[model samples]
Target: MTDFAVSYFGGRVSLRFAKGVPFAIAALVIAVIVVGITSLLAGSYDLAVWDIPALLSGQGDKTALTVLWDLRMPRFVAACLVGGLLAVSGALLQGATRNPLADPSLVGVSQGASFAVVSLIVLWPNVSIWARPIAAFAGGVCAAMLIQWLSAGKRGENSLRFILVGIGVAAIISAGTSALLTYGQINRASSALGWMAGSVHTASWGPCAVLAICAALCLPALIWVVRPLTALRFGSELAIGFGLPVGRAKFGVITLAVAMAAFAVAAAGPIGFVGLLAPQMAQRLTRAGVGAHLILSALGGAVLVSAADLLGRTIAAPIQFPAGLVSAVVGVPIFVLLILKRANSSQL
Candidate 1:
């Protein structure tokens, strides 16, 4: 799996693979470049790939420029921001909870966001679209706060216990969302389901503007959380011993993570597993601990989500799946492999 090129048919139809160290190093660079270019170039139109230079110089055709500037640009920017948001939230959650499986969605963040959106659609169907992100952000952070409280001081932390609690909370909220939609007076279930699945199909400058503003407001707070995050890894005692304001810091981080998840969900309907996969992959690739460079993890996240989105759109063509679906289908196996690897190593 380490080898880059595999030859067959007299080396005429060679295949290639990348994994482990070589994969991490080479893939990081290639992923950054490929994701950036492909993300910019992809869309409904047929632009000349070689004509990228003209577009960069603002000399491309009007239609091509429209595609690049209007349609593709916002979506591409969203992919990067939403992706980074989810990944950072994931890394922070994992570090805070000292759980490899911790993610924004797991602590009911996604469910909370979904609930707020679904309620908006059902109770106030005529409400303007501009307000959905606001509601979702409010609900998601509240849920995170609640979950953090519940999980606090729980020792050796049974991962399954956390998962079960999360699932239960999520299930209840999901049922509430469904109930709101199913009510004859307000059957907005379809909208709820769609949002739950995650899609950026309706992405535009509006949500993009909101996302950017939130990122600017939230990134500094997130960075502050990172320092405490490192202290948190050796358990809350050491964190408090280091004079880190453990409880307040954890609350702040969970709140920000919730907001990030909510913003992403509002913009792209709860894109699953980006949070779960990105930091884990970064760790595996760099052999770094949870407290490693936040910037690298963020970039890794952006590349992953961007590439997955590209794959989602291109693989099926006219009837492409959403990027979120693409991640679940692709990410589940990798998640399993990580679990199996951990289990095997533990027994040995």
Candidate 2:
């Protein structure tokens, strides 16, 4: 379907959108808001739905205020931020590589961050918790750089080569992480396992602030990549024919994607499948341009993670499952379905 275009500044500025894009975006926004509110209200602590307004206004009881603000709010915010970041990262990766199967985890970013954080937990148990995010970001960047270096050749970067190298690097990193968990101090390893499970149960204001800052920093990069991402969907050769610096554009997009994924992993461990799932879901929901698709993906991701976290928290009462586990349980079947569909189409 062709897009509807709107012009402003005597056509100097224009925006184009697919027919269903607005509705899809609205639905996703509503879903996120609903899930967030539900998450804030539904937890181990009994919070009446009506009490939310009072709590928000600071007119509620001290304990209620503490529960709402100190405990639930941070977790809610972290889940949304992590989900949105991962989804956007995934969208960027899929566009840059022109591969529907592309994801932050598939590309080694999540594994790198996970390895760094796990290493800290297992080997440097006494280190300050504040350092984990730094370690994660550094590790993720290093891994991405390695992937780029390995993938680049005399002919320039190949998307297939990038994916293959990322897979091999991710495997090696995963093995190293597993070894740390296997041989490191038992108690520390256990703690690391909890983190690796990707729970936001311990989310606090500091990490929330850090995540927000990372998201803010990424905004400009996201905008800058929109045109390049659109061009890249047609392949590097075609993008170059259109006068785009395909190599630099891919590098920039991948770098931006890595930064978003690493920050999310740093904030909330490695939440799997979100980066893979959200963009696909958004695309299926609406035939939109890259920018609209990204907005929809971010909102969809926020809803998915927030709802998963809420279910994990309330489903079994005091015993809470990690958000990442819940997401995997939901995502794995859908992922398989997508693969089957793709395979069938290829055969057709």
Candidate 3:
């Protein structure tokens, strides 16, 4: 294979590794492991770090195994899964739409999912929990289609135009969600609020299984659309001229992305900014090609969510904060800096 090098952040980086592994990717993987291990060990119950391996091997104390295997493990795995899914969803959206601010939450997909779930809970209280993911996926797909239709034009889809329209759609959906809560009984509203707040504190095997199955089903579709998504970054005209079925491919990408986000919302309640932060951070850290960027973005998202959940767990001790709150708290400053940098570089 040939080697490619790029200079980023005033430093020269080389992509000359064997077996197609980049240095940045290796670093991200290591970071994810470190974060995962820390999350496994730093919960409310003080489990000895060394006991984890023994517990996995069926030799640890009953109490330690119960804490590690029963309580913390599910949440840990769910955080990683939800984080990766959200980040990949964001990468696909940003790549397909060429929008710097494209994210599941910001672009109305998450809000749409939230609105659907909230509405279901308020209006159809007897609906099984298993059906919530389907509702969320439907809502997200509708929002994505609406955005596409609203943004279509002779000059092709514009990034800023899509962002503006998505923001409007999100706000409207959010308002509707609020109205549902306002009209519904207090108990149902409170339950819905907790889900919307986005915590993995209640993580259990069922939700984890559902998320894993969704990923298993979506992975092949994601792989199929990668080429078209990469081509799209170069512009729709060139993509169409290159014999790509731009319309069909773009629709497939949007659907795949929205489904992933919707599943994450169903599993973890609309955790915001994993999609936004993960892709940009991955790009800056690696500067590799689109494929590498996608993988790194997924890893980065996993690390961010795991780390944030861990922080929320330990920061207030005995009163855990929702991961969504921590994500917004952390994401807001990074978002501001991104906006400032883009403005200074005239990319905004």
Candidates in order, TM-scores: namely 0.83, 0.91, 0.91
User: Which number leads on lDDT?
Assistant: 2
Pitting candidate 1 against candidate 3, the one with the higher TM-score is: 3
C-alpha lDDT of residue 316 in model 3: 89
Taking the tens digit of each residue's C-alpha lDDT, what string does model 3 give over 1-348?
455555666675333322343777888889988987888788667877787788878787888887777778888889989999999999999998887778999889999999999988888879999889999999999988887887676775667667778889999999999999988999899889888899898998878899999989998897788679878888889998989998888888989999999999988998999999999888778456667778888989989888889999999898899999999998888877765655564421
CA deviation > 4 Å runs, candidate 2:
7-13, 126-130, 147-165, 343-348
Q: Candidate 1 regions off by >4 Å?
A: 1-30, 149-156, 184-188, 287-292, 337-348
TM-score for predicted model 3 compared with the true structure: 0.91
lDDT scores in order: 0.73, 0.87, 0.85
Cα error, candidate 2, residue 53 (Å): 1.3
Runs in model 3 lying further than 4 Å from the true structure: 1-21, 153-155, 340-348
Instruction: Residues 1-348, candidate 1: write the lDDT tens digits.
Output: 443566888987654434344446556767777776887777669776788788878996898988887777677677877888888888777776776776766668888898898888777879888788799889888777666556544354555456456767777787787778677253466666666677665577877888789788887787577578878878878888999988887777777778778888877887777888888878867554333445556777788777877887888787767888888887778767765665654421
**Clash numbers, per candidate:** 1, 0, 0
lDDT of 3 at 36: 75
